[model samples]
Target: MSLAETGISDAPLILGSHTLRSRLIVGTGKYDTLELMQQSLEASGSECVTVAVRRERLYDPTGRNLLDYIDFHRYTLLPNTAGCYNAKDAVRTAKLGREILLGLENPGADWVKLEVLADTKTLLPDPVETVLACEQLVELGFQVLCYTTDDPVIAKRLKQVGATAVMPAGSPIGSGQGILNPNNIRICLEYLKGEDPDYPVIVDAGVGTASDVAFAMELGVDGVLLNTAIAHARDPVRMAHAMRHATEAGRLAFQSGRIPRRLYASASSPEDGVIGRTRQDRTSQ
Candidate 1:
């Protein structure tokens, strides 16, 4: 049976103008080999794969590009301004990626992952430049997905400036911390999804394991986007499978509606419903 046949997924993830089958978005870098990356991506169950447009060594010494291994028809490429520290450079790289994808006749030409970094050390998005780039990209008729910090105000500002999707970081990029501040993420969801409940708010970065993906999903995010969690794992394929299952489980759990937390313990089986001596025992109590 296929994974979809398991009846786990609820609805398709409508990201920007694209309708993605899986809620997990995987990155197309950091793998040891192109073949490994391909295998891991296949295992991830993600319909969209993000690639860094800047400083990503697209072409190797053998003149073989990373795009050669990817199946353009199967995966929609979300080009990202990974290394751009300013809005102008990010916009230029985004345009370059669109041109390149358009030349390839791929449907991903209309969309871009806008990431204007604050600095080299933190790899956090420069909130101001990111917003500027997002506005510019939207003006250019591009579906801009802004990668920002876990700040709810910043996320709100991005949505206000016409960002198609606002991807708030779970924690520092590639930190393996895994949703260090879920309360902040919760507020991000509350603020972003206030009026538009279907608005896609993906938790990007700082996902170390499958549980992290599940936790983010349980927090009511539309999706979880990660790179190092799967790519840098001991076994990328295995990790991919784990993340896929986690995504499904988390979404299902959220839909199921968990019981509220309590300080005191509650009885599993009620006293009134107990078998033989249950009524008498309850009366005595």
Candidate 2:
């Protein structure tokens, strides 16, 4: 049988109106070179990539931009309000990105990765401003995928505000600490998917390695959006491949169901099934 026949074919990730095959979303920054970024993205097998819409980020110091390296046709661009500190700037940046993508006729024109930071040091979301921007952007006909903290209540509030996808940070952005509190992440998953089971809740940021992605997936997150984890790796291209496979493995393990954790050991082979071992002898042991 073909590999796909062995149950590798799973349901696609659904975010609002977009049905995507790749559950991993990468970012378009931090690579040693633009070429490495392009290759790493290809290796990642991601359908969507987040791009910071800041002018400096949009254009490299060499005067060229992501448009020069990234093929918009091959990858859908999810424009993000990376540096925006408040609702107004975030909204404006989202609009500007929409305009740019609309001109390019890209599929991501109407959707965004909304990030409204509280400060540069922490890179945490301003919960108040995040909700405000989400509401405003939704009103403007943009599919806003909000970025927020791992607080379950805040996640629910973002969903209530009409966020297409609620992305909770795995930890601090680029901190590489992975999922610091799986319990909180579990709660966030429970709260967000409780009402709408299939609602897309992606874990964004703080992934350091492939296992981090797999761990987040095992927690039942719909997807993962990461950059530094892959881009800043010693071997970025190889790590990208690892992240792709990790996503698939994690999703498959979740679907297949795992054994419950136990303090005691359970043998794969039963004592009764052992040759030359009588029931009385086994019992005596």
- Evaluated with TM-score, which candidate comes out highest? 2
RMSD of 2: 2.2
* Candidate 2 per-residue lDDT over residues 1-285, each given as its tens digit: 633789657889999888889999999898889999999999999999998876565545767677899999888899999999999999999999999999999999999999999999999999999999999999999999999999999999999989999999999999999999899999998998887799999999999898999999998999999999888999999999999999988887777788899999888885566788788888897
Q: Give the range where candidate 2 is weakest over 10 consecutive residues by summed lDDT.
A: 54-63
- Tens-digit per-residue lDDT, 1-285, candidate 1: 655698655789998779987999999889999999999999999999998775555557677688899998889999999999999999999999999899888889999988899988989889999988999999999999889999999999999999989999998889889998999999999999988999999999999999999999999999999999999999999999999999988888888898899999888776565567766677786
TM per prediction: 0.92, 0.94
Deviating ranges (above 4 Å) for candidate 2: 1-7, 56-62, 273-281
Clashes of each: 0, 0
Local accuracy by lDDT, each model: 0.91, 0.92
Q: Worst ten-residue run, lDDT, model 1?
A: 52-61
